[model samples]
Structure formats: C-alpha cells, structure tokens
Target chain A: MEQARISARQLLMLAILFEHGSAMVIPLGIDAKQDVWLAILCGMVLGGGLFFIYYRLFTYYPSLPLTAYSQQIVGPFFGKIIALVYILYFLYIAARVLRDFGELLLTFAYPETPLFVLNAVMMLTVMYAAYKGIEVLARTGELFFFSLYFTAFSGIALVVAAGLIDIHRLQPVLEEGWKRVFRIVFTQTLYVPFGETVVFTMLLPYIQKHEKAKMVGWLAILLSGLNLAFIMAINIAVLGADTVARSTFPLLNTIREIRVANFLERLDVLFMIALVVGGFFKISLFFYAGVIGAADLFRMPQHQRLVYPLGISVLLLSIAIASNFSEHIKEGLNIVTLYMHIPLQVGIPLLLLLFAIIRHRSSFLFRKQEKK
Target chain B: MAREGIKEIFDAIERNPQFRTTASVVIARKQTAEQLLSVLTPIDKIPANQMIKTLEMTETVWGENLNVHAGEIIEDFSLAGKEIVMSSFRLDRNLKKGQQQENVQFVRPPARLRASELAMFKNGKLVRWISGEEARGVLWILNKIKQTAITVDWEGKEESVSYKVMRAKTEIAAKMKKGKPVLTIHVETEGDVGEVLVPIDFTNPANITNLETKLRKEIKKEIQKAIQQAQREKSDIFGLGEVVHRSYPEKWKKMKQTWNEQYFPNISVHVTVDTFIRRTGLRSNPYFP
Candidate 1:
C-alpha cells in the first residue's frame, strides 16, 4: 500500500471541502435568478455524468496517475505533452485559489493587509500540508469537516430562525421556465462549482479502496451538488434574487443579516472562521495536486522536494493573477467559465476518457494474440 | 468632509472590532436623528443597543414595522425598487408627562411608545414622513399588522367601536389596466372586540354583519390614505412594483424606469378588507345595551 493513501470517505470529504470553499461564498447558478435552484439541479446531473467519465478513466489506469497514464494512452511524444499541460493546469488552479483567499481577506477581513503577505503566508502553510503528503491533508480535512459544518449550519440556522428567509422572495417558481434555467446551467454554471471536480481525477488514484474510488467520487459529486444547491437556495431566499445578484459575497451578506436576538448578533464572525478554514483546505488540496503533478511529470522520486519551489511560484503567480478585485471577479465569472473551464475541466477530460478506452482495448487485443 | 477624511474614520471603525459589534443604526429624518443623539445620555446603559431593542419591541407588538436597515434602504431605494419606509421615533415633547408616570425619570426615558409613523425615503434619502393612520395602513398592506387596533363608526352614531387585531394578512396584486400599472390590495384580519359602547345586541349576526361592513370600510379608509400618500410623495413604498416584476416581468422592465415618479402616482389602487371579529370580549352585550 502507498504510504500516503486515503479511504473513500476521506476522499469524499476533501472533494466536498474543496468545491464548497469558494462555492458557498460566491453565488452559484445565479443567472437563473430565483430559479437558480433548478439550474443547480440540472448542472449537478450533468456534473455527475462528467465525474463518471473521469472515474471510468481512473478505473482503466488503477495503479497509475494521470501524468504517467497519459503517455501510455497516447504516444510518448504527445502523451508527455498532455501530461505537461495537466501539470501547468494544476499549478495555475492552485495560484487562482490562492488569489481567491488573499483577495477575500483583503476585501473583508483585512483592508490594511497586503495581498502578497496573505498569499505568501497561505502558500507557506499550504506547502507545509502538501509536503506532509495527502494522508495528513486528508486527516486534517476530515477533522475540520465537523467544525466547518457546525459554524456554517449554525450561521444559516440563525438566519432561518431570525425569520429573514422569506420564501415569498422565491415565488412564481419556474416563472421563466426550465429552458432559461437549463441554458444557464449549460453555459455559465455547470463547470464552475461542479466541473471543478475534475481536479479530483488526480487525487482519486490515491484512494486505498481503489475499486470503490469511482463510487466514492460519484457520491462526493452527488452530495456536494445537493449541498451547493441548498446553500444557494438559502442565499437567494434570504437575500432575494436581486440582492443576491448584486452582492459580491452573498453568503457573507446573508449571514450579516442574521439577527436572532440582541446579544446573539454579529455571527458573521463564526461563519467567516468556517469559510477561512474551508478556504485553507481548498487551496491546499489544489496546491497538493499541483505538487504531485509536477513531481510525476518531471520524473522526480519525491513530491515533498517540489513543494517549497511550487509554493513560491504559486505565491508569485497569484499576486500577478489579476490587477484588482473586480477584474479577478470578471475573469472568474466570465473568462474562466467560457474559456479555461470548458476545455481544461470538461473537454480535455472527456478526450482523455475516449483515448483511455481505445488504448486499453488495443493493448488487451495485443495480449490476446500473444496468448494464442 | 473630504473623502479621505471619511476614509480615516472608516479605517478606524473597521480596525476596531468592538465598534462593529455595538453599532446600532437609527433611521430618522436628519434633524430628528440630530435631536436623538443630542438627548442620548452618556449614562444611558448602552443607548445604541437599547434603541435597537426598543425599535424591535415597538414593531413586534404594534405591527408598525418597516425595515429601514441600511442594507434594506439601499436595496429598496434602487431602480429595481424605489422606496424605503422605516419606523420612526421622536423625543416626546411632553417629557414632563412621562416623568409624572414614572417615579424614576431615568429608568424610563420619554421616547414615545405608540409610534405609528414611518420615515419615508426615496433613493436612500428621507423624502417625507407617513404619519398615523397612513403609516398603519402601510404596515397593513405589507402584512405586518399585529396587536393593532382599528375603529369603525357605528350606524351614524357618534359612538365608534374598535377591534383589537389578533392576526392580519395582506396581499398586493400588481397588474396592468389598459396598458398602465394598477394595484389591488387585499387585507384579511381577525380580531376581538376591544371596546364597543353602542347599545345593540352584540350576539346578533345582523348587527355583527353591519359592524363587519363598517370595519371593512374603516380598514379600507386607512389603506386608501396610505395609497394616496404614497402617490403624493411619488414613492412605491408598498413594493407593488416588486410584485409586478415577479408576476409581470416584461411590463416591469418598461415600468421600472418611471415606476416611482410617473407610473406609481397615476396607478389605480383598489382596497378590499375582510375583518372577522372572532371574540366579543368578556361581556356579550354592552352596559348601555
């Protein structure tokens, strides 16, 4: 057994934590307006199908990671090229998540705090976790899972108790019909909080219950999808579609409106703590993925050796990611969704699956002839 | 103040976590806000928090609640929705009377309790005050009426009867009439006879029916007054525009730009009330009867 392997349950928690870290704060499937819940449902169904494809690919190459298997599936020349592309993709995603955390801190928690300093500190801690390997990361994620749910659920529970969530705001259900909701599900929303599950393709190979990894991956996507939909629905119900659309952080704004009584106010602090912890897990997982991919692609013996250098590079890349917050938001909402996400998260993965099936069949045929 | 001068204050407030926790926003007219801060005492046991509690209790029991929190104000005052109505309080002019009631003056300061007025805002600035019956009507239309009282004149008699409302429900339908915006307000409420001095058979369904008609008329009067006042101020504080947007999205897209000034004032408003007197209090018939 690999020294740093995780069980199916740990894998599920890590994926949920990673997807939830950013999705909970930023509004998901919002273009569908009050019917964003429907958008999320449609998107999740499609997201599950996409995850299954990735899982199928994983099953074909049970012992090998994406970096090693790409070369085997494709010719050595193009396969190494594809592997290098994935390595860069992981690194870039790590930096993007780092930027998200740093920008969030700069915007809400610390106005005086420099982005570089926040990124540097976060990257160092994330690098340490990544260097400790996936086993420690998985354990840490499993441990923090309870705390995350406690604070997040309690914050939302208070809001619901405060009578701030008006179901009337969600009235005239499917007023615009399912067509518009599905359109939004397809174009803008699916790949974001859902298709971002593609990162798990790398991590899935490390599950100790290798046969059940595929089942666990699909289950993780299913659970996280429902959770994302529920969270977004609560936000829309509390903040209203118009307000939720305008807000930069809908969950933060919703939590701020939670007034249970006189003294039990300002509970956004508790939610903020939960989100920061979640953000840590998200960034570290992506950072871990990047470190592992780099080590494998470069034919290195150990992933621990690549952590600090990758961490420093990620810090620098995150600082240089966007000029300001609005631009970052614009790119995140528009550019990333339309361009990078569709291809890297969805398109290339499907292509990988197709190629994997073809190669496996050809190799099996070659062995059959030799046996004869 | 220069923007930078305010920036320093913002920075300081943000830096100090305690400031954020204890902060209570008081929504009033600029002059009224000034007067409140002036009379607010240093020894007033956390005046900011006290004011918030006071505001909530008044809204809780009175049903004169209008959310004028800063965020709500910004939201309702936007182009999407163009009005803000908040419960308002003033330093009682007759503080001496309040002092007479209480042995210790400081224990209960002379802020008015029966505050049935709402500070009205357009585009985040106070435009006017909707007072008394009109304010209650605003709450009535918004379905916030709780433990409120409404009176009806009984059969041309000088004596009137008041019903103490136990529950109230309201709904506003925003539909177009002849290619223009129109609103219909429906109010359903049940209450007990609080005080009825007229000499009549209180148990008689015939008399009760007459009373119900008068009650509906009185409730309608309040709703009409609120509608008229909203028109006069050219603000859609009732949020009928939002109703329109939800039910009639395409129409709203065109009306939203002029909904506040042009369409709101001119829109036709129809009020309907269903009042059920569930209880006749301790006595079936009045002493006079």
Candidate 2:
C-alpha cells in the first residue's frame, strides 16, 4: 500500500461535516422551537464522547482500517459480516449525502436541471480526486477549509449585522420545558452527526503520525460542535424560535435575509455556492470511502475502478429511494432520526467499543494465566 | 506492483468526463469573439467625415424630435384649473320697535342743515329740542302741561275716558340681607315702551348663597357631560385599560373576547373641578351715581 499522508487540518475538515451534519436540517428548528439550540448543544456534548470512542478505536488499531481489524479481532466470518454491514452503511450514507446536495441545489438554485446531471458532475469531481488518492482529498480539503469558514462566518455576521434580529424572541427561556430539550438533545442531536464521526476510522490510517491523532480528533469534534451551536443560536436569534423551528433550512433562510443597502439583496447565490462546494466535498469523501471499503471486502486488486459504478449507483439510488423532497425530509426527520441515525450512528459504534474492551480484558486475563 | 499501477491507470479512466466539456465551452466563446471582431472591421468602413457629420446631425435632431413627440402627446389630453375664494362676514344690526331704520348722528350740522333750519324758523315762532339736564327739565314740564291740557280738553269734551296700565315685579336681595320685592309700572296710549333691568341683589348673602349652589350644580353637570363625551369618543387618556391589561393578561384576554360590550360599560371615572369668579355683570354699586 502507498503511504497516504493527511494533516491534522484535513481531519478537522472531515470532522466539520460530521459535527455539522444536522445543519442542513437546522432550518427545521422552526418546528423544534427553543429546544433547537439545546438539541444542538446536547448533540455536541454527546457527539464529543462518541468522537472520543472513535478516536480510541483508531488509536488502538493504528495501521489497519476497520475492515481488516474487525476480521482480525473477531473470527474471519464474523468480521466479514461486520465489514459488509459497514460497507453498506457507508454507501447508504454516501447516497443520502448525494440526494441531500441534489435536493438543496434543485430547491434553491436550478429547478430545471436534472438531478442526474448535478450528481454526475459532482461524482466526476469526487472520482477524479479519489483516484489521485487520500493525499489529494486532504490537500483539497485544506485548500477549501479557510474559504469555507470565511463564507460561513461572514454569512452569519451579515445576518447579525442586518439589525432586524429581535433578542426578545428567545424570551420565556425553556418554554418547551427541559424534558423536550433533553429528548431532542439525545434523540435528535447526539446520534446523527456525532455518531457519524465513525467514518473517521477509514481516514485514521492515512494520518502521518499517530501520536496526536486522538487530540486532533477531539479538538475537531469540539470546534465543529461549537460552530454548530453558534449557528443554531444565530438562526434562532435572526428568525425567532417559532420561525426557525418551522423552516427547513434555518441557516440558509437566515442568510437569505441579509441585505446590504437595498441594492445588494438576495445573496442566496453566495450561500448556494458555498453549500454546493461544501456538500460536494462531504458527499465525495463518503463515496470514496464506501468504494474503498467495498473493494477491500472483495479483495479487489484496485478500488479506484469502483468509483464510477458506485457513484452512478448512488446517484440513481438517491433519486429512486424517495418519492419527492417532502417525503425525503419527513423520512430524514421522523424515520431516519429514530432508526437509521440513532442505531447506526450511535448503537453500532457503542457495540463495537464494548466488544473491543471485553476482548482486551479477556486477553489480559489469559496472558496472566499463561505467565502463572 | 505492476498490477497495482495497471489498476490505478484503469481507475483513472473511469473518472467523470464532464469538466472538459465546460472548459471547452468557455474557451470556444472567448475564441469566437476575437474571430468575429477581426473578420467584421475592414469590410464595412465608410469615410470618417461623412460618418462624423451624420452622427452629429442625428444627435441634434434627436432632442427636437423627442420634444415634439412629447408636445403632441400632451396636446391630446385635457387639463383643468380652479380658483377658490373664502370670505367671513360680520353683521351688526339693531332691532327697534319691529322696524328697520338707519339713524345718523352728526357732531356738527353741515351747510344744508343750517339752510333747512332757517327755512323752518322763517315760518313763525321757532321751537327747538336739545338733550341735556336743561332739556330734560324742559321736557318734563312740557309733558305735564300736555297732560293737563289733554285732561282739560277731554273734560270739556265730556264723552268717555279710557286708561291702560301695566306692572311688573322682581325679587331683589342684598348680599348680606334677605329678599325684597321691587315693582315697575308703564302707562302708554297706543305707544311702545321698553325697560332694561339692573339687578341690585347680587351682593346679598342670600342671593350669593343661591348663586353659589346653582353654579356648583351646573359645574358638576358640565363635568359629567364632558366625561360622557370622552367615553363616547373611546379615548383612554386615564390608562385604565392599560392597568387592567397589564395586571391580568389572561383576564384581559378573556375581557378582550367581548371588549366592545364589557370593557367600555361602567368604566371607572373620576373628575375634579375648580371655579373662580373674576367679575360680576354691570352693577358694582348698590345705587346709580
């Protein structure tokens, strides 16, 4: 295997997507109300713990991807089964991300452009970078990271500076009560983005030095968490709790309200550009990881060739899986939030950690007995 | 290692091919603009003098043409203008004996009046009437003489005698004293009589008490009427509604359910009145000077 190097910064970029994964749905805060930020904060704290678990796993098995390590730890057959399950999970996530990006573009930008064209264009870009290898992906992430942060922060500042925001809207704090807040934090926040950091396992092998990997991962998780919390707070302050809860894309709509001197209005174009670029990076990274995992499972000589086929498959899968945007959003919120998001994101990783710990303890006991 | 390299080459071939298409479109548009500009310049050139002259003429004519068009468009429409006058009139008219008359008083008689006076005096013994203390005494003596002569004449005639008399009375009281009755009489033969009353009881203690009581009652009624008018106008200057709304939001919400019926009726009201008499009407002294 070629040595593929990635900086701590690249890891931070990857962590941002996971940490802010729920951002796309933050606009739905209008439905969630005052509890939205609480949900986000809770997600961050819980997601940080999950990120730590992931970091521990990667630190324990430094050189191997999850696919090979699981097989070594558990028997080959069980390991293969688990690897297959992970492969499917990654591919599904890739497809969902593609669909999410496509839906956002279609809803906000070009209504007439076919989704296949958009997905294909994005997949091509991802495939090109993936072929160049993980080093290319990390470098690309590095190049875009600052611009991403600049666009995001400037957008928020513009919205805040518009002076239309009413601080009284956050009054009667915890109007929905703590129970709903806790439910949202646990059910809506922790499981989705925080747990999704499990994908970091694949990238850990490419890290240049393993010494500070855990610290880097923790810092990335924390920074991403704080960023999301700030975003949610701004959305609430700008749009009000009720409006934010009802909105499907709270941050985007908040940015949409940014107008400078009346002549420079409707800067949703800036947001759309940033979103499409950021979403491309996120989806492509997942797609590449899925292809590599699939190739690893089959013992294929090369994983790069699978990129196009998998991209096409995912593009079609995303289109066919949901009937329309409403259905997709509903499923994402109601069904996926409960089942796929909670169990896969949180449950599987916890189970894997438990298994790893039990195995470590038993091996320690067996080694002591042999020494005796 | 060779096989991995071969696989890598194959993977590269499998990547998306759309970037080339977009790049080509951008390149082509740039290339075509240069080609078009290069091809069109030399073939359609006119002399510079003619071109300059034509351009100048067009610029000069365009302004006039636009103005003419504007005038023609305006001519087809109707325009309207109006002048408004406002005036306020003051009327001063005196009613005397149910007849309208213009009476002029001269400070000094003109030459025509002197001539008319001399004509009147030339007929016989002259008689004149003037107004002052001396004239009032003379008028009294003449009135008595006329009355006596009329009586003698009537007595001598000895047919019949008819007398018409009228009387009026008012209750008068001093500021510190009790009430008193005052009477007035008028006697006339087919003539009109008029009299103005000068009330002398204003300073009486009884009259003062009555006036004070009446004035206080009238002030109270006036205050009530003003309050009723204010309520009818729905002015909440007293901030009663604000008090109720703030103190009881839920109750206010319920009250607002039928605000028109419940909130306006029997509304809490308070009023304070202060009165000062600066001057009395006409009679400052008990008797005429």
Candidate closest to the true structure, highest TM-score: 1
Give me the displacement of residue B247 in model 1, in angstroms. Answer: 72
**Candidate topping lDDT:** 1
Give the range where candidate 1 chain A is weakest over 10 consecutive residues by summed lDDT. A322-331
Winning model by DockQ: 1
Task: Give a tens-digit lDDT track for model 2, residues B120-238.
Answer: 00011111211222221121211111111010012233312111111111111112112211111111111001111333233233433343343334333433453343245343222
Question: All predictions: root-mean-square deviation over Cα?
Answer: 20.1, 41.0
Q: What is the lDDT of candidate 1?
A: 0.74
What's the lDDT for all of these models?
0.74, 0.51
Per-residue lDDT of model 1, residues A1-372, tens digit only: 125778889988888788787777775667788998888878888988888888888888887777777788777888888778877877887788788777666556764356789888888889889888999999998998888888877877788789988888898799888889988988866887788777787788788888888677777778777887887888888978876765557788788888877877877687577668877888887777777877887878888899888889888999887654545555677777777788887888788889888877888999999999
- Give candidate 2's iRMS in Å, 1 decimal: 42.9
Candidate 2 regions with alpha-carbon error over 4 angstroms: A21-31, B1-289
User: Could you tell me the TM-score of candidate 1?
Assistant: 0.56
Which portions of model 1 show Cα errors greater than 4 Å? B1-289
**TM-score of chain B in each prediction:** 0.80, 0.23
